[model samples]
Target: MSGKGALSGTEVATHNSRASCWIIVHGKVYDVTDFLDEHPGGSKIILKYAGKDATCEYEPIHPPNAISDNLPPEKCLGPVDMGTVKRVEIKITDQEKARLGRLQLRPPLDEILNLHDFEAIAKLVMPEKAWAYYSSAADDEITHRENHAAYHRIWFRPRILRDMTHVDWSTRILGHRSSMPVYITATALGKLGHPDGELNLTRAAAKHGVIQMIPTLASCSLDDLMDAAQPGQVQFLQLYVNKDRQVTRRIVQHAEKRGIKALFITVDAPQLGRREKDMRMKFDAEDPDEVTKSGGEVDRSQGAAKAITGFIDPGLSWKDIPWFKSITKMPLILKGVQCWEDALEAYDQNLAGVVLSNHGGRQLDFARSGIEVLVEVVEKFKEKRGITFPNPRFQLFVDGGVRRATDVLKAVALGATSVGIGRPFLYAFSAYGTEGVDKALQILHDEFEMNLRLIGAQTIADVVPSMVDATNIHSHVVAVPGDRLYDSNYESMQHARLRETTRAKM
Candidate 1:
């Protein structure tokens, strides 16, 4: 038994039943026979690997320490011979394959075909509190409904009879080209949706050749996210300024070191809006019950709760942009910008781009839809001011309630250089993990192509304001006084100077 030709370990052990197996650890043989009843992942999958070398399969399914801790090591009879174990081949029939495929297919079909399809399903799949936190908006949720309702107001006047056999849906954003006009916006608590969380979303985006913006409150660390991404894949890091500027600086520096293409500073959430659903649920601002209820501890590394707890530094201002610029060469994008004046101010700052968003109607209840503001902002820049950035070019990314490719197409047709999708992909993750996300991307890409063909445009660059007829396009504009713009600029400058003073104090 000591020789190489002989079985020296527990492989030669004898099991009382052929339906079970034995494993060797620390030169001891343990019969997993009666232990099957105590298995957590169902004994059937374990039984399939019985009477054979189950070491490889067992280690991944159940860690050795897990088995050792739960089960007494004395269960091992002795150091049995190793020749008795044989590998087993589990054959899956065509019927079984079809059944599993059907099982996987039913979820996406029943849950993600349309924008509304996933609302109830998401609520069903996720914990009640977590669902409420993501779905609810500020105050009465009128803005939330407005975000969706505004999409209906901009009716598409699709054109026909133009040759569009081969369309180029790809476009450049932040000097990097993406496969689609859309990218995943920053959404937090990915692990709440699935165990893989941001990793799964990153994989899905990589597979489809789209960029995924990692949120400030991502469950996975910034380094872990960078590791999950493929080399040269584009990723944008979203930063939420907190009470501590040092912590925010660390995150921005980490993004720069890890090759994050852009830094998105979400300016909308100076203060957390009043999400009534969480309020009704008695969501503890200190220890949100969703953390424990969702099967884990809350990650406070991003200091989100601190902001929610009224610890935010109210002195944050636009003059801080240079500090951000000095830390990283990557483009800085301002998210939640709604007005044309702010858009102009963003351009004047020499910042990279502006995401015309209202935090998906979660931050402000009365703010206009991101797309609604997009048309006016672009019109102001291109038609009124006649200003444009060169090379990488300035971008107007719009988000909120974008579900279809046609919705994206309409956004681009109106004025959006690119679009950000927030809720739809989250729904996809809930319905199915990475696969569901891939399906959602595929559906959107297909719709984008079809809509492009219908509109008589072959390339994303060809989609411009002229392609869209102004006859049926209903539009609205809310004007802010010249002083408001001047005040915003003055406040931005004042904040920048304050940051300098604070640095001196430190």
Candidate 2:
């Protein structure tokens, strides 16, 4: 069992049962009998594929090295002899063929100029399930729409005739160097979009000198993404506190030991939102708490969001701050601080920073966008904390509906140390893989150069509050122009298309 080229597929197949189980993954045989009950998705799926090649099922959900990383030694049977192993032929359904056909027809990278274009193409190219999960927000999606609309309210007051020969948009985020005033933010279940998952972000961020925040639920294991990075490349961890404090402590300490620069504990989403679009696809068979299917009920189709988030603790509170601080020396930041009071509290607690966010409008409906909250937070910081803008002790960050360098500049101009772009990069990689991410970064670079000069700012530091009139920023009642491109990319709800069924008539 320890050596390669020993076991045959026929030999492995004999162990299939509840008592003993063996499966082949990436040519290696694994005895997962002990792991069935331990699996987060539960035991049924593993038992279904017992003594067979589970690579196809496993690859889509777990990281490439997940089995190897999690399984203990001796339970690890060595590689199967391909010569003796019978090939498992998969039956491709007509709908899968059709979806792949659409994937093949996607626009070439050279034709994609903007982030919205990547999203438009991704909607056309990605599987319906992936599109629904990535694009969905909370109920009614008022907050989701508002996130983008909020930026439009803050019109730029660009200066003229300033020397703009060489504009520098590079800046520091959380005291770490960055090529731009934005970082690639965390998003979950990336393999549903592409096989490499968050590895695309890791590689592109390394090449571009941009920081990336790794999601706890990313399809790739944290080690896989971190291992893919070049030395000195900075990466941050976004934590969704585990219900088990011991589990949370271990994860936090492990991240610190792994050289993670910061910890952004997500403060929003104490309870996962009812993203109806995503809920439409949740698998009833695997769900224990699935709502009864009916008009406007929490049905099973919530997909990855519902499946992977069961471990998150709803009891996470400010009291946990000292515990986190005691566990790791890494800079700790509250990732979903909604208002300035919380920002002040974070400052008072001597935490590193706060990210003004609403979980990108996925946690709660009608939540104001981070930029809108940034105004109140900045104003309050000065008034309550006696902390002025750009206070070194308490850095502020913002994310959501930021589609352009100008949106980033607006946040920077107000007081955000930097902004985070999540779905755009997810869209970029979903459509074009690693190269798409590179191109997205390139597009931002080009936009930053042009927008900086146009705004009369030669550097990121020059982007001050006076450069823009935010008089209407917090005025939610004010009308603002719509984002036509983002609106066009959005598809109204429809039932998930079942793969073209082929049935035999009796």
Candidate 3:
């Protein structure tokens, strides 16, 4: 299997039908005929690349181990001879060529002053498929926009005449030290943006003393990331529970064994949303007939999320809470708790914490922002628990649209343990690799120093509720000035234009 037993492109191209499908992915030949019927994205898509190198289509959305993990060992048809393998000549359009050109022309890392700058440059430089997948939110994208908009409603009640001396943003997340009051939150399929993917995050987190939440569907395999971690660097695992309990059990136990500091059970996304932009760039559009043939109610239109996340167990409920506890000693934190009732229940359940997030508005459209949810959680805590956060027994955290240090400060003041920023770090590495992340951290450090003094605080602990007035945080109808930076940088919601019908060749 390891030898030069390479098949020529001519020999591979002969088997081009559904009955005997052959394909090459990353220089490896695989006879996916049997696996076709069982493939989650359906057979037609794989069948579309029958007898061809599918590496271009296969790379972005799927994890590196996806083919190996899902395909039977017998189907892996050994190595492909690259010298004889005919290259798939894709005609590059002018727009695409210009987009690719931006990669070489990106501004220097030092010029990128804030998280938004990374987003701006990444949008300009990233390939269309990658940008579409990374930026797409749920239907209408109301909550997606609101995630950042909610921050504008809260006004800072800055105090003057403070000592104005040395400020410290360093704090602990899940009992581990951090350089700032923020964590690099989980985002799937890192290789879509950069070659190294989440390893970029792992390296950046290690360098700066922040926790990186490993996504279940990361392009890099679990061991790939765990192996890359520096000694004693705290990591967290975000679970998208598999329907097969054994698989879920193995994953949870393995993460615990690997010394993951905490287990973040994703309580949202019972179903991945209709990310239309991703759907528009359909990878599996070639085989719509497979849906009828397979006799499954699969939605081929949901794009990358549907294809990759088909394995997540939608049956996850409160009953499964104790089952998660029965599996590992790692502290449990619900990664997507929405409202006060759920947060209260999490407290009663003896869970370590709750992340007030809506899966970064990728799950449900119009879902309230995490910071807004934090308001209700803090209010409930003050009512019942008689504590306004700093509650070691059950910490509460928030994530989503955290572009500025001021947002973290606001959440901390309103009773959050810390905040999580996902997309910015993703954009950072996408634009300039690991150094982009380091620079983003440095910018935050500068902002934390200035913002803390302005708000009359010397440390994270001093960022109290009085420092930020959130009287309008929950007012969903209130009109706030639009975030021009985010709006200008954001690619607006794309409605899929109908594909042009092919004409008969003369």
Candidate 4:
């Protein structure tokens, strides 16, 4: 059965039981009976589609190469004669019909004037699972709400009468030129929102000359993203270290070999957090007994994040940094540093840089926002290392709660090499696919032109620490002010709904 021409449907159907199961995905056949015990989401899901095509169920959540990468070459049973195979017919539910209606009613792309606009539209149109995974943070979501709110505490101090006829928002990120001070950061499972997935960002970034950090859990294969890039397009890799050292090493070495500019190892999330909204979804439908029979002691209630994250190594530590360095020549950066001490440690360790982020407030609930951490990181760097801001040797990057070019500029003024805009781009592509991302980038470009002139700064260098008052950045208990931008875009967390009962006869 191993690559011996097209297998007939009759032959494939014979191995449907748990004793020996075979499935078709994107035209190829695979014998997954051996893999069932190791499947992260549990074997039940795959068993549901045993002896049939699982392409529809597999496409959104798993990377394109997931099956091929995990299964041995001999397990690949070659392509099947699609004509003889019975395809799975996906029924359109009432909820999907409503979502489609909302999609039809989406605001015109030009009307999406700000980054927040894309988010507002995305909330209306995205699938519940995708929205929950993207928008939900850790328990109570305090840091999630605070990430954007913290930016509001900062007040800009615009200059007067500086020649701002030609403002340049363009800057270099880790030695690569970017058209703006913001780069599209890594967010996983792109296909949940759009079919093109991470490729939407790749194509959009290429057109706008922006940098994109590819997520380790991207639905599209790493090779697919690289193959889609235009000449000289700069992209970075965001890695979640695996339990198997050899697997992690292969990923790192492969990324470097494929011209990945830098390696931004995600230092956060040794284990995926309890994002309650995501937990509420509880994607797995199989019984506990069934799941345990496959993957030992599985907690299927944790939803999509838990389902796909079993491979992450909790044993990863500082000692592993040297091993990473030994495997590749690419510049290495820690992606989830939340405090100055860790940032300084990264510098001392002779690493490239640190991203002052708290995993977009999706990990620890009360963790400080990246922008707030930037101030502390900068202050410590100057005092402890006698280092200046935007040090070429140790670049300080920031991500989380950035919704506007003003937000990007504020981070720049406070001493960030660049800010990573994650959710807005995710929302953009989710709502409008590649075109949505294009409009979002254009909106930022327009905002950069207007706000840079308004702030009286002609270039990224003109954005200085003194240009913004961050006195209240650390004060977490200040009275809330009405922010129209945030109010318009923020989707409030909902309480569980009561079951509908039959109305009494009137």
Model 3, 99-119: lDDT tens digits are 878888999987888889999
Candidate 1, lDDT over the whole model: 0.67
Pairs that clash in candidate 2 = 281-301, 282-300, 282-301, 282-302
Model 4 lDDT-worst window of ten: 293-302
Index of the highest-TM-score prediction: 4
Models sorted by lDDT, best on top: 4, 3, 2, 1
lDDT (CA) per prediction = 0.67, 0.85, 0.86, 0.87
lDDT for 269 (candidate 2): 75
**What's the TM-score of every candidate structure?**
0.67, 0.87, 0.91, 0.92
Q: Which residue segments of model 1 deviate by more than 4 Å? A: 1-112, 283-312, 388-392, 469-506
Ranking by TM-score: 4, 3, 2, 1
lDDT tens digits, residue span 400-446, model 1: 97767877877888777789998778767765778778878888887
- Scored by lDDT, model 4 comes in at 0.87
1-506: candidate 2 lDDT, tens digit per residue: 23455788889888888688898887788999887666645566677778888887777666454576567888888888756666667878787798889888988888998999999998887877788889998888888888989999998999999999999999998789999999999998889899889999999999999999998888888888889999999999999898878978888888889899999999997889878777665453354432222111322444456656766789988899999989999999999888777888888899999999998889889888999999998887777757777666788899999999999999999998899999999999999999999999999999999999999999998999999999998788888888899899877766556656689898
> What value does the lDDT take at residue 377 in candidate 3?
85
- Clashing residue pairs, backbone N/CA/C < 3 A, model 4: none
Question: What lDDT score is found at residue 124 in candidate 4?
Answer: 94
Q: What is the lDDT of residue 444 in candidate 1?
A: 81
